[model samples]
Each structure stands twice: as structure tokens, then as C-alpha cells.
Target: MPQDTIPNPILRGFNPDPSIVRVGDDYYIATSTFEWFPGVQIHQSRDLVNWRLLTRPLTRPSQLNMLGAPDGCGVWAPCLTHANDRFWLIYTDVKRYGRTTVGGASGASLRDFHNYLVTADAIEGPWSDPVHLNSSGFDPSLFHDDDGRKWLLNQLWDHRPGRNRFAGIVAQQYDPAAQALVGERRNIFPGTALGLTEAPHLYKRDGWYHLITAEGGTGFGHAVTMARSRTLEGPYEPHPDGPVLTARDRPHAALQRAGHADLVETPDGRTWMAYLCGRPLPNRGRCVLGRETAIQPMAWGEDGWLRTRDGSGDPELAPPSPGLQPAPWPAGLEWEDFDGLDLPIDFQWLRSPFPDELFSLVARPGWLRLFGRESIGSTFRQALVARRQQAFCYSARTVMDFAPAHFQQAAGLVCYYGASKFHYLFVSRDDEHGRHLRVMSALPDSPQADAFTAPIPLPDDGLVHLRVEVDYERLRFAFSLDGEAWTWLPEMFDASILSDEATAPGAPAFTGAFVGMACQDTSGTGLPADFDGFGYVERAYAAKVG
Candidate 1:
């Protein structure tokens, strides 16, 4: 075998907790969205190298809500599988936190796990309405055995005597036709072994059932552990040397945390694994972009043991096979062409219930026109479009022309996580003057009601161009009277808080699953704002290397 040459974090930024499945030559992956709306992003890859967001499976209001902005709530880890010529997805919807109590009763903490099964004739679906699994756990995964027996795997709170406080992996027989578990659920492996195991995925290979899990917590100490059982019901034993993949032994190990891995074999019978990890910047332990997705080559030892190429017993930055060749940017999904009928898959709205009526995709033979909605701060349910955080260092620019009857109508480009954490440059009609540019950050818990810099004057002419340059650590904002002379704005934001640990407490940590870049507008009154001509480009580090 050739030396495993790993790609540089194939999916960078906020893409976390990846679950991948291969069907024919096509590969599909899904990730967790803690609070962001349009939960459980679905991505497709051809050679497992380059990826593009295909669609968001869960978009119905009945399926999700952003009220009180359910911190760390919404879609958890999702598993995608194809069996018997049908595609199935098993996922968990975290309803509410167990923190609030009524009267003298104490509430459950992160309890109430609701699992749903959605099946489709095609990978890209008109998926069936969710068949509520009604399971008592989260991070649900599905596996089908050779004999056609289906098994459902999940992580739930351990309720055994003396083990009430811990979480563990549970497995039960599943009936896809019935959309429910057939037999009694049994505890397979408790977090007690590794102290905090979750995200359990089972694979049958060479007549042995392999149960792989994430442990040591989802922080910097995160790792991937493997166990094997000769029979489905096990006296399973942990590998002699635990944690098949980890960053602890790497030279740049300080910057990585390998966890929540999904293993798959390519069309040519080559084994590969995709997992999430983060690259830490100076002074900031994690960037707001959160966890990113990476691939590595895996091989089975003579004894059927799984290991990486180096045999260093740890996952490396590069895999053995030549990485996926980059393909030309997919059409109808490029961020550069902003004048389209609908927002591209790369763009995502903030943590608000997306109202379809408030937005549209009108081709009209030319240019994308975004008709915005009411005020940004007026309601948590307003339409505020955004995309995932793609590159650590990149520039996003957009040209806009909007007419606001009142000064409250604001439209611009923003890097959004939830309502609380976002920075944007907007052009609003000034009360005394004409249009002006204002830069602001919406800190969720800040005492400062309005954390905005002084507004800068803009030309009365409707046309305005804005640019934001992110240097991984600091983001610099600049705007121009024309596209030529760019003037740097005084407002610079520290975007280190976008890490999985900092932003999402119980969420898995990895890098680069963000929806990637968005454009939006808000109104103080019941009015609409129009935007046009948005463009973005990833800054080449070599351009700044000198």
C-alpha cells in the first residue's frame, strides 16, 4: 500500500460530528447542528475528497424550533445508511433541557431523547415523514447485518444500580417496516469504561461485530475507541491498545481532537474513515467555525485489528491514498454568483425558524434577488440568512442596493452562529443623512444593550460594496465608495469563541462543517429589503506568506 496522504481537513470550519455512508461511487455525510436552523446538513462527495452541501433533510417547523434559541439543542449526531436498496436516516431531536423545574420537582438534565427514522427511495429524497423511534437516547445509529437483521445503536443515560449518572451505548433489534424497536433494549457498553463514551457506531466485518465509540470527552482529550465481539451479544473486549485513532501522539497533536468517526470502504475495496477535529489558533483554543471533517486510511492487521498506515497507533494529518482530486465548483451552488433564484446550499440562516414566504429564488432570466424581512432584533423568528464558516482566513464581499423607507431597514453580509454570536456590516438609511454603514456584534449575555461601533457615512447613491477579511484570529472589516479604494473599518472582532466547546457545550467537537457564507436583511417595520451581487473568495495563505 502507498503511504496514506491525508487531505488538509477536507471539510473545514463548523462541520462537526460527521456520519458518512457510501452508495455505489457516491458518498453522503451528515453533521450535527446545535442551534442553527435547517438542522442536519447533508453533504455529497464523489471521491471522498471534495464535498458540497446537497440539502438539509430536516426543515419543517414540526421537526424543529429555535425558541429561546434552545442552546445546544436541535439536531444531534445523525447516521445515514443504505440497505436493501433503500436509504434510511436515524437521528435524535433534543427537545428541551432538564434544567428548568416546576414547583418542588427537579427537571431532567438533557433527557427526553426523541429518535426518528426517515426512509427514501433515493438518497436525495422526498423522505418519508419521520417515524418516531421514541427511544430513550440520543446520537442514534442504525446497522443492518448480513442476515438482514437490523440493529439500532444509541447513547443513553445509564440507569443501572450505582451507574445512574453515566451514559452508555445501547442496542436493540429494529424493524424498519414497523418503525420501532422489537426487543428489549440492553446496555452494550457504558461510558464507565472510557469515562465518557458516546456516538457509538457498529460495523460487522470478517464475522466480528466491531463497536467503535468516541470517548475521553469531546474536548481536546477526545479520542476514538474500538471494541470487537465475535457474536452480536457480546462479552465484547476492548482492544489491547485502546483508542485506535487520536491526536495525542502527533507533532501538532495540541491542535487536534479526533472523535465521532464514521468508517467506510470505497468502491475499490479501500477502507477510509472520516472524523472531526479542530485546528487551534494562537491565544484562542477554538475558532467559532467549530469542528472540521477529515479523512484517513485504515487497514486491518493480521489478527483483524484495525490501524492507521504509520502503525504509530494514531491517526495522522495525511492518509496513505492520494487525496480526492478537486473538481470544478458545482453549478447552482457557487457563492460567487449571488444573483440567483434561491440561496445556495452553502448559505444557511441564523438560529431562527426559516419562513419561506419571507424569501424567494427568482431567476427572472438574470441576477439573484433576495427580498429580506423585518427587524433583526425584533423577533428571534425573523429571516436572517447566513452560511457556514468555511475558511480560517478568507474575504467575503457583497454589492447591495436597497431602498429603506425608514432607517430601520438594514441589509448586509454576516458570519452567524446563533442569535447571540454574530458580527455584520450593514447599510441602513440614516435618520438625518442618507445610507450609512454600521458594524455590530450581538453578544448574547452582554450587559451592553447595543454593542455597535460608530456608524460610518456612505454615499447617498444606492450602490455600496462591503468586504470582511478574516485572518483566522481577527476579522477586519472594510468598505469602499467604489470597488477600488478599500477603507478599513475600526471594528475588529475576535472570533475564537466559535469552538465546539465554547459555543456548543454538549455538541461534538470537530472542524469545518459550517454552512459557509450568507446574505441577509432585517426591518424595524413590516417591510422588505432587497440585496444583490454577493461574492466571496478564500484567501490563499501563500499570498500572505511573504
Candidate 2:
């Protein structure tokens, strides 16, 4: 993986709070698709060492619905940009958070999070429908000035009562011909002291207006804070050297919760940045493949600040080629015969944006039915589709057909990460194991995780193939039937409890692991499950692949 070098998450698994832009030689980035669905994950790179997956612009339901939205809560941190010629974006849905923050009784910390805004002259779209913008907080930004003026910014959530509930970063004046937000909102940047400041991102350079934030609270003491201000309204200053990037003192760094950054520039002026990393699992512990998107290289100090071009604030496993001419992109599809009718922009589903009421492809044209619904930790509806485990040793497989006549009906294969974390395996029946295949699990344990495991009959069956491998924190499960021999499942599991540090002690794991296909039928009756294709590869995370 080298052509002068460049390979630091250029965008990997669960993608997180990135937010990049370029528009001229094309470079986009966007990220953060919390509860999954069609929210935002733009991608598209020309030679920042190749990338590709150009669209997911909140594909309709009046632009994002999220049915019950909860499982890290729908889309947060979007912002993508370009200007006048159009391409703006901005996001944040998050409705309600964990339950009782610790012992409960805090103030201004219940977090509901809203915030919108859209635009598109073309990044692939007729896109242009949301423009709400402001539920008071949750990583939002706009900024577009040079006198054409436009500004917004966010992270102003201060629910009072000894305040500190991430109450910093604010701004205003954005009236793109009255699309709204005009004048006085100020409070510019009060970060530093390593508080939990949110992700702001503004930048002016020469006359200096800088800003860029994300402090110690995305887990494991994350960072990235920077500040400046020559008067875009601010008394800003911090960065006489403090977090311009951080690995929280690099605990043996391989990228871990490394802050939220965003900055571009590379016409020949060279200044990169991208941010949002995390790769943990052994020793530094738990990340399961969430928070990804890295890109390094930054340097601008003649006392103008902005470090890490090797000033070593950590996070740069290979950064060096911005010199272009290395466009590599070809490797996707080893299996997924759901035979088209749409479903394979690498898959995603959950929090229903009405995925045909949960799965369908002309009913079974090539198979991928699902139907079932409700129970896989249902925040509302649940058929679960999934995709994105992005390797650390991977393997997935599928085949299903399902015949669960009872036991309240169930379907198959899952790995998941929310609804308290997951495991699943399924087939179900039970008039005393009439059909059988079981394995349930939901881990956050004692912190609350449910369990089931103990069935295994299966013979009146013809399809059911399933498989899962995962090596990084170990996960097993396997089965076959007439597909040709395989059986594992001697119980290995704890794939790091799916992960975002073990499905968060009580919330805010911001998504990661996920293996596909699920159904369920609390017995309301729908019951169906077809599947027939879905295969994933990627196990060779450095060495082990049979």
C-alpha cells in the first residue's frame, strides 16, 4: 500500500465526524451516519490516494426520517462544503441520549440535538430540502467568507446549573439571501483547559480566524483543539502549543480516539488534516472499528500555529503522498447476489426510512426478503440490514431461507453494536425445539445485556448457511447444512462486545461493528426471511487468514 505513501484510514469502517471539502480537483469527505440509513457519508477522492462512494445525501423522507432514531442516534457532524456554485450539507439529528447520565441529576445535559440545512448544485443531486439549522448544539458549522459573507457555527448547548455541558463555540450571521440566521450569536470560542468543546471548524489563515475544535470527550481523552481570531469576533488564542492533535499522550499510538479535525488545501500548498480516528482492541482496548477517516500532514508554523506535519501530535501511520498520481480504486464485490433492485452502496438499514417496511427486492427476485420486524432491540421497527465491519479480520457469509413457524419467529446472522450491543444467530421454533438454531445475546451486561443460547436442531432445513469469523477480539459462530460442511460455534464470542468500548457503559459509543441480515416477529405475524447472498472479506489484518 504505497505510492509515495498514504494510508491512514483514508476512510474506513463506521466513518465518523470528518467533514472535508475541495471542489476543484475534487476531494469531498462528509462522514458520520450514526443510526445508519441514508444520512451522510459522501467520500470521493481524486488522488488523496483514492477513495470512492460519492453519495448518500440524506436520500428523502423529506430528507431523513429516522423512525425512532436511537442507537447512537441518527447522523451527527456533517458540514461538507463548497460555496455559491453550491454543495453545502450540515447535519445533526440525535434525538435523546443515554438514559440517566450516571446517577442522574445533571442540568442542561439531556441533549435532544436537531440542526439541518442542505444544498447541492451537483455533487450528484437535485438535493435541496432541509434548512432548519439549530437545536442549539451538536457539531454544526458553515462559515464561508471572504466578504461574500456566510457563517453559522454551533456547540452552544448550555443547560445551565453549574454549566459545562459542552457549552462553547457559537457564531451567527448567515443570510444567504434570507435562508436565515442573521446577526448576533457570538460567544465564539471558550475552549482550552481541555474541556469538552465541540467540533467547530472555521479557518481564514493569513489574517487568522482559525478555530478548529473537538476536545477531551469523544472517549479516551480525545483532542485536536486549535484557536485563533483576528476578529471574526473572538478573543481567541489557545495553541501556544496544546492539542493541535492528540492521542492522549499516545498510549502506544496506532491511532486511537484521535480528535475531530478538518482542513484541506493541496493545490501545491500542501496542508492536509481530515481527522476522526480510532483503531484500538488489544491493550489500548475497544474501538471495534468505529470513528474512522484519518489523513495527516499539516504544518504552518512560523508562529502562525497549526502543527502535526510530524511535530508529532500523533496520528500519521503513513502520510506523505499528496503529490497525486496514485489513484487506486478497484476491489469491492466478492459476493452480494441480492441481484440488484438496489441495496449495495455497501448496505445500510435500521431506523427505517421505510426500507420497503424493512427489506425487499421485488419480493424475492434474487432474494433478500426479511419482513419480520420488531425485536433486535427495536427502537421502533427492526428488520436490520447492516454492512460495515471494515476489517480487523473479517469473514461474514450468509444464505438463509428461514422457516421459523413459532418460538415467536426469528431469522438469522447478526453482529450489530447497539440496542445495548449484539450477537444473534437465530432460526427459531420451539414447541420444545421444533426448528432450532439459537444464540441471542445483547451485552452491556450487569450494565445490562440479555442472553439466550441453547438450541441446535435444524434438519428439515435446506438453506441456512450463515458464518462469521472476526479475529480481532474474537467472535466465532458458523453453520451450514447441505451447503457443504462447517459447524464451529463452540462458543467463543466477546468480539469486544461488538464495540464502541463495549457498547458504551450507557450510551455514546457512536457506532462501529455490524454484520448483516436480521428479522424477528414478536409474533405479530409478518415472519419472512430469504437472503441468498451477502459475503464480506478482509480478514488478514496484518497476518492470519486461512
Candidate 3:
């Protein structure tokens, strides 16, 4: 507790389900990226408080393919560790999302999940391709024992009609020599009795094996629980003091749904826990930014139990910093001139590979050329490149040099939350109106799907400037032929349409909100749109106390 301040969320915006590890004085953490390319996001930190985005593993299309992935189905949980002097990563790919009667009973649904592994000689890869593992369940982690033995720990899914969807925690012996998990998979623990047990991680300390799990279904009920045993595999005893950490019962807490924790011991003999938490909108309780990564300091008691700094089982906004100095990185990018050969690290695409043929910087120097593909909301091929919306109040702008010759071709700025909900400001050529500019607010499966503004006739110069100003409550659109003179649209639509609570009753909204450029060539003739520049600015918004 020497340093003055400690930023709680080491990594911000959509970085959830953190797993941390230490190699000498350096530390590394990885998080999940569902349906987004560059499957696993890795970050490096010298001090536990300040972190930097290092690199993303699962870069190749062969390693990750989200072609037909649904809203929240792709990569699940990623567990990163340092074993055998190399960095090892284990993650799950959730393919299908539907009801199933696997084993639990009838009317029980389970996702089709698969586990895989990849390793690198150093923290920054050259990472190896994935090695297929069993699909027993999701959130697979690798635990190395003292005697050079490897084991894989994950959740066992139970589809019985009346049983818990998350059955229990299981571990199987993995042979490094054979590069496969051999021997029988043993059910070590039946969860902490809190139910919905998942995201299990094992560690050995003080001659005892410690296990951690996330329970209570990832919403306001989410939490972190712990158990320990004398042996690696046995009847583990749950912590007598209830959940080691959680915010589910504390409705007025600053950080909500704090769970899915992973611990790391620094070289200076300090312990910290990196977990997932979210800040929801006041009154509505909508988490538009998705789950983010937060850290809490820990201390060991005389009873050999690990607890938070205050032992209240709640997270802190600014915990005491460790020994190292703060070396924070930029939260997100604000502008892009399209002068570089590659997209910035902050940019990402929806459920598709980073198409070299679709988006290009070489095609038009100092500009980004995006070749149109399928329609905007298609789960398959779509021409879109976006970045996560890190804040609720922000302004996004883009200048386009595109003249759609037909109604089937359109290009413009987009606010895409998932497969079902989005808003678009586009320019297209209509049979009756020639080329026109319009705004469409879409929230499919919800009540806001039919909202569209009247089209305005556009000039034929092929140069246009579009802007979308976002506040906490609504979004306003505007356009201009000259950069200085602007014309505001007539409609002010509700911003809550791009939220987690606005989706359909049974749909999943795991990912956060995004804004960027998207185009489509529904006519089967590929058309390209050139964007001269793009800018996004996040303004300071006051937080409402719960």
C-alpha cells in the first residue's frame, strides 16, 4: 500500500474473463473475444496497476473462423499461464447456440463448445497453432504440478432437465511427451454449492491445492468462490466464509457482477486478483460496455485463507498500488488517417476474418478502401471494420468518396452492437431519388426495427461528410457538403437501442457496442468505398450514483 493511486480496471472495454500469470518480474493477462477475430487478447504489465496491449494470439484464419457465429457465440474463456518456460494459452470456441437434451434431462440446452491450446517460446509470439482438446465443457485451463506433470481443468456440462447446466469441475491428466491428455477425467468438485459453477482455475500454495470458480450466472448474480484441498485431486472443501469475492448481493456497489478471478504472485511477494466487472447505466441497469477487467489486492490470514484488502469481498475503485511505478497505455484511439499499411490495434471486425481483399489501404493511398460484400446484418460475409465504444458519450465522424450507382449498393457509418441490433447512416442511389442520404435505426427482434428517417437528396460530387453525435440518452445525425457548414437531421433517436437490455427475450448480448464504417453490395457486383479520414472523440460524462 505504498503507491498513491491504483487504477481498478487495468484493461478497459469488452476485456472480460481475465486470467493472469507471472514470469519473473513481468506479468501477462489474457481475456476472451467472442465472435471477434484475433481470438485471445494478451496484455503486459510491469506493475499490477498499469497495463499495455501486447499482441493477439489466434491471428490466422485457420486458428479462428467466426463465419456463421451468432451474437455471442465464438471464443468463450481464455486461460493464460507460464509453464515449461513458455507461455501457454487454452480457450474455448462456442459454435452453436440452441436447446439440447445431452445428459442432464429433457429441455436442457447447451452450446457446442470445443477446447484448444497454443504455446509460444516468449510472451510475444510466433505462437503455435491450436492443439485440439476435449469438448467436455467450456473455460479450459492448464495447471502444472510440482513434479513436472500437466493437467487440464474445465467445467463438465450437464443437460439433465432439472440439473444445473454447469454440472461440476473436472480435471484430466495431460502428457507433454505424447502431447495429449491421457488417463481418466475425474470429477474433483461439484462446485461451491452456490451453483452455476464455471471458470475454474487451480493453483498450489502452502502445500495445499486451491481452486477458484465463478458462480451465479454472470449478471447481477455473478460472483467468485474458492475451495482448497491438501492434494491436487480430492474432495475439496469450500471456504467457510462463503464466496471469497462477489458484488451480487451489494446492489449499491460501484462495480457490478465482479467475478471470474485469477491470482498472481509478484516477485516482490505481493498478491493480486484480476477479475471481470461491469458498470451499468443508472436506473436501467444496462451494461453497454460489456464486461471489463478489474484487479483487487489480497492478503493472507492466519487461517491460510486469501481475502481482499478489507475482507468485505467487494472491489475497490483505487486499491493500493504494488511496488512498481505506473506505466499506463492509451485507453483507445481517437483518430485514423488511413496512412498506415495495417489497421490499428484498436480496430476489429465482426465474426469474420480480416479480409485482405475487402478492406485495403494500398488501393487508395492515404485513404481506406472497403469493398462491399453482403448486407449489413448478415451473419456471414459483410464488409465492416469497427472499434469498441469505450464510452457512452462520444462523437464519430467519417468522410466518404462514394457514389452508389444503384439501390443495392450503399456505404456509410454504422453503430453495430451485434447481429440483430444496429443503426446506419448511409448514401445509396434510389431508382426514384437518384443518390440520397438516409439514417436507419434498426433493433431487430425488438420494438425499434421500423425507425427510418426520410431521405435527403445528395449532390453528385462523390464527396460527403457524415457525423453522428452520441449523448447518454440519444444519438443525433448530421451531414455537410463543405466541412464547415453542417445540416442536422430531423430525428433524435433513443441510444438505449444499442444496449444489452434492448435485445430479444432469449437472445444473448455478451459483446459491447461498436461504431465504424460498413458497406454492402447486395447487387452481386462488388463496389468499393473510400474513406479519407475517421475520428472518434469521447467526452467526459458524469456518473450517476446507484
Using TM-score, give the best candidate's number: 3
Better by lDDT, candidate 2 or 1: 2
208-256: candidate 2 lDDT, tens digit per residue: 8998999998877898888898988888988887898888967888888
TM-score against truth, every candidate:
0.86, 0.37, 0.95
Global Cα lDDT for candidate 3: 0.83
Candidate 3 lDDT tens digits, 133-249: 889899899999998899999999875567677889999998877779999999998986678999999988899999999998788788899999998887899988888888887
Q: Candidate 1: misplaced stretches above 4 Å?
A: 1-4, 59-69, 97-108, 158-166, 248-251, 322-335, 351-354, 363-380, 405-408, 429-434, 443-450, 459-461, 501-524, 542-546
| Total colliding residue pairs, candidate 3 | 6
Residue 94 deviation, candidate 2, in Å? Answer: 19
Off by over 4 Å in 3: 1-3, 98-106, 330-333, 448-450, 542-546
**Per-residue lDDT for 1-546 in model 1, tens only?**
322454657776677788999887788888877666677888887766667778787777666655444545667888988999998888887766434333323333435568888878886676777878765777899989999999988887643334443477888999867777899888887643556778888898999998888887666777888888998767677877778887754646633877889899886677787887777775666655577778877888888878776666565665555444544245433345555555666666545555554555562323344455544532355555556667777767766665655565677767655445567677777677667877767654356634788888776666677777777667777777677878888666756544454443333333232322233344334444444555666766422310
Candidate 2's TM-score: 0.37
RMSD of each candidate relative to the true structure = 4.1, 20.2, 3.0
